[model samples]
Target: MVDADQTFVIVGGGLAGAKAAETLRAEGFSGRVILICDERDHPYERPPLSKGYLLGKEQRESVFVHEPAWYAQNDIELHLGQTVVAIDRAAKTVHYGDDGTHVRYDKLLLATGAEPRRLDIPGTDLAGVHHLRRLAHAERLKNVLTHLGRDNGHLVVAGAGWIGLEVAAAAREYGAEVTVVEPSPTPLHGVLGPELGQLFAELHREHGVRFHFGARLTEIVGQDGMVLAARTDDGEEHPCHDVLAAIGAAPRVALAESAGLELADRALGGGIVVDEHLRTSDPDIHAAGDVAAFPHELFGTRMRVEHWANALNGGPAAARSMLGRDVVYDRVPYFFSDQYDLGMEYSGWAPPGSYDQVVIRGDAGKREFIAFWVKEGRVLAGMNVNVWDVTDPIQRLIRTRAQVDTEALADPHVPLADLLP
Candidate 1:
């Protein structure tokens, strides 16, 4: 058990930071824990911001990870609206703001997370152009959607990743004419393979979503401080009322780098380097969640996975490691995205061409299917669209590394449960 007087400072109060603090208390740490958040509001779950929250299906309070009373009852000190500008590694302390208030820590955890990558195109600063990253961003987007009077205006979402698609789906549900622009030949080409991405492209196209594949956005045209249109490199100008950039995110590691902690080149994954224990170069300081770039057991390479599951699992793993527990933080990374009428569940690791054989289960025509990514008779990864129950058994098969009969596995009538050990 940790002494009540001991100080533990957690930087960045997102899902990762909040979960880490909760796990520490649950693990018998009764120390003085301080959660420092640059935002005024407490920690909240971000996944819904693109789907339910933006669609007004969920209340703002409902999105918060925990209520204010829970923190008070747990004796967790939440320092909201406070920024930790620098880390004083020599004194084992962290400095905040221009006034320079400093606090010493016995152990520190950095879960600074990531920020939305902005478009470098001209007219990006226009009033109608937006980038969703924080609660404030979502709130502003909500206001914009409300102002546009749902279903009447056009919303141009740049990028084809999960973030872009989810927002496009939300805007569509609000009755807005939604168009998704991507430089890639297929949407989600980075996450899902080209075959699967093409399938998704067909899915969206059927639902009235215009796809601008291989089209590069050259400029964001605006008038009177409001975005008016997006001009492509091909010189095709598409009129839009509001523009949202969902290109992806970058790690917020300024504090870590300024503290003299070693950093990997941004060209190489661009995340804070950490060992299996999630410890940085400094023994007292650690990193976790999206900002953490650690070694992957399956690929035998260093990479950073920015997903909701990483934030949920990595934070506690780092906290447990900090508490002197022997733990090797390795789990088959899993994530999901809700876009339009599709609910996608994915598991395991997939490097480019990681799977030599693709065994598809269920019927894609029915709009409920599972695609199994296999290599050397081993399940490398799988994606289930609008079929959550099927992935449960596939996940089990992936976890156990069971040899599946390719013929039997592909049989839709056989059911995924029969393929599991």
Candidate 2:
């Protein structure tokens, strides 16, 4: 049991940060826990923003992770709208500009999430352009969609990843004309490969969403400080009232870097570097969530995944390590995205060029299916759309490294449980 009044400082107010605070209390660490969140509003559910929230189906109040009363009951000091500008590692303190307050942590957990990548092209600073990383961004986009009434207004969504597609789906549901522009030969080609990319592109195109493939965005054309159109490398101009840049996200490592801590090996690629226990070079300070680059147990590679599940699970793992408990942060990477009427779930580490065969289940035309990515007659990774049960058994196989027959996987009638060894 911890002392009744021990001070612990946590940076960032996203899922990872919030979970760390809750877990500490639940673990009997009844201390003075301070949560530093830059956003003015309290921590809320982010995934819903692009789906139900934008559709006006889910209320803002419903999305709050914990109630204000819960925070009070747990004795949590939530410093909303406060930013931790710098970390004085030598002094073991975090300096904040809000009230010139310095927080000293016995062990600090950096869950300082990520920010949406913005286009540096011309007219990007226009009034109608936005990136959906925070609740405020979603709220503003929602207001615009509501005001515009969908029919006359046009929305140009750059990138064809989960975020871009979800945003496009929401806009189309509202009756707005939506056009998705991707420079890749196929949508999500960089991540899902061309075949899976074609499946995703087809899903969107079938929903009345226009596609601009193999087209590079040269500039965002605008006038009087408002976006008007997006010009492509092929010299084709596409008109739009609003633009959503969902290209990708970058880790918030400025504070970590400034403290002279060893940053991740993302100088050329992406993510912050961390050991198996999720600790940075400076053992006193630990990093987790989307910002930290964690080493994979099975794949034997360093990677960074920006997913909600990982953020929730990684924060406490890092915190435990900070408290001197040795734990290896290893789990099959999993993520899900909801677009239109699809609930897509993907599980396991999809190392580049690891899978040699794909066992597809159900009909793609019906949009209800599961696709098993197999390597050497073993299930390496699995994706399900409208099929939640597939993830459970596949996750089990991944956890145990179970070998299975590829023919069983390809057979639609064969249950996932039967393939488990």
7-122 per-residue lDDT for model 2 (tens digits): 77888888888888888877768668888888888877678878889888999887677887887788888888888988988888998866778888767778888899888788
Model 1 residue 399 distance off true place after TM-score fit, in angstroms: 3.4
TM-score of 2: 0.95
Give the TM-score comparing model 1 with the true structure, all chains together.
Answer: 0.95
- The global C-alpha lDDT for each of the candidates, from Candidate 1 onward, is 0.85, 0.81
Clashing pairs in 1: 151-175
Residue 80 C-alpha lDDT in model 1:
90
RMSD vs true structure, all candidates: 1.8, 1.8
Deviation from native of the Cα of residue 293 in model 1, angstroms: 1.1
TM-score of each: 0.95, 0.95
